[model samples]
Target: MGSTSARTETCKSTSEREIAALFDRWNQSLQTGDPRKVVANYADRSVLLPTVSNTPRLDAAQKLDYFQHFLENKPFGRIDSRTIEIGCTSAVDAGLYTFTFARTGAVVKARYTYTYKWDGSQWLITSHHSSAMPEK
Candidate 1:
């Protein structure tokens, strides 16, 4: 860890917990509908495979714009991350994501995956891809 943590708490041995905390912030900020804070979690040239639109969003700025556009169609929903798998300095966060529309009262649920890389201290989102659940 590079010791540049102000908002993130880090323990000596388990860095995964620290990294997961950072990811939780990402989820909270997104729930707040603050695209800027969501973008802040991404690296400069991160990639987002937003399956909602079936396109890839490259770069933090573009991803922010994507979030804004994407959020418009599907309102806000509760997001939860239940499981994470890590190896060395890289980790993948996977769990449930949902979008509840305000206009039609439709809720879309999906399993989301976020790939994170620990750059010494800070954990940055690299690739994010989400897919809707099968018709059930």
Candidate 2:
């Protein structure tokens, strides 16, 4: 009788810096002012709880609709503070961010959380939740 040993494999965790940079990539997408470009960052099966919209976006089409309107203001985002957590093939970045609307000159402070998954070739956002801050 022969006994076989069980083997365990360790997954390499993504760096916090890399997770943090994902936000920058998403933000850059916003700079394009093209909803399609913005939506490209998200996975096909993803959720977007937007900062400006009451309705939640559950798919790429819904997300495209939201971003189409949101992008009209020419929004630009900057992170105020964030904490990132890395996993085997997933990561989360959550914190405060400020958005400056070029078209309207409106400044909004919001809290955001973005969860990402590595899809073999690239990282894609799986869930994104954002809401304006309660206090001024």
Which regions of candidate 1 deviate over 4 angstroms? Answer: 1-20, 73-81, 101-104
Task: Pick out the ten consecutive residues of candidate 1 with the lowest summed lDDT.
Answer: 7-16
TM-score of each model, in listed order: 0.71, 0.91
Clashing pairs in 1: none
Q: What are the lDDT scores of the predictions, listed in order? A: 0.73, 0.92
* Candidate with best TM-score: 2
Q: Kindly list the per-residue Cα lDDT of model 2 for residues 52-90, writing each as its tens digit.
A: 999999988999999999999999999999998888888
Model 2 deviation from native, Cα RMSD in Å: 2.9
Give lDDT tens digits, candidate 1, residues 63-110. Answer: 888888665544665566557777666777788878777656888898
The residue-level lDDT of candidate 1 at 76 comes to: 62
Clashes of 1: 0
Query: How many angstroms is residue 25 displaced in model 1 relative to the true structure, after the best TM-score fit?
Result: 1.1
TM-score of 1: 0.71
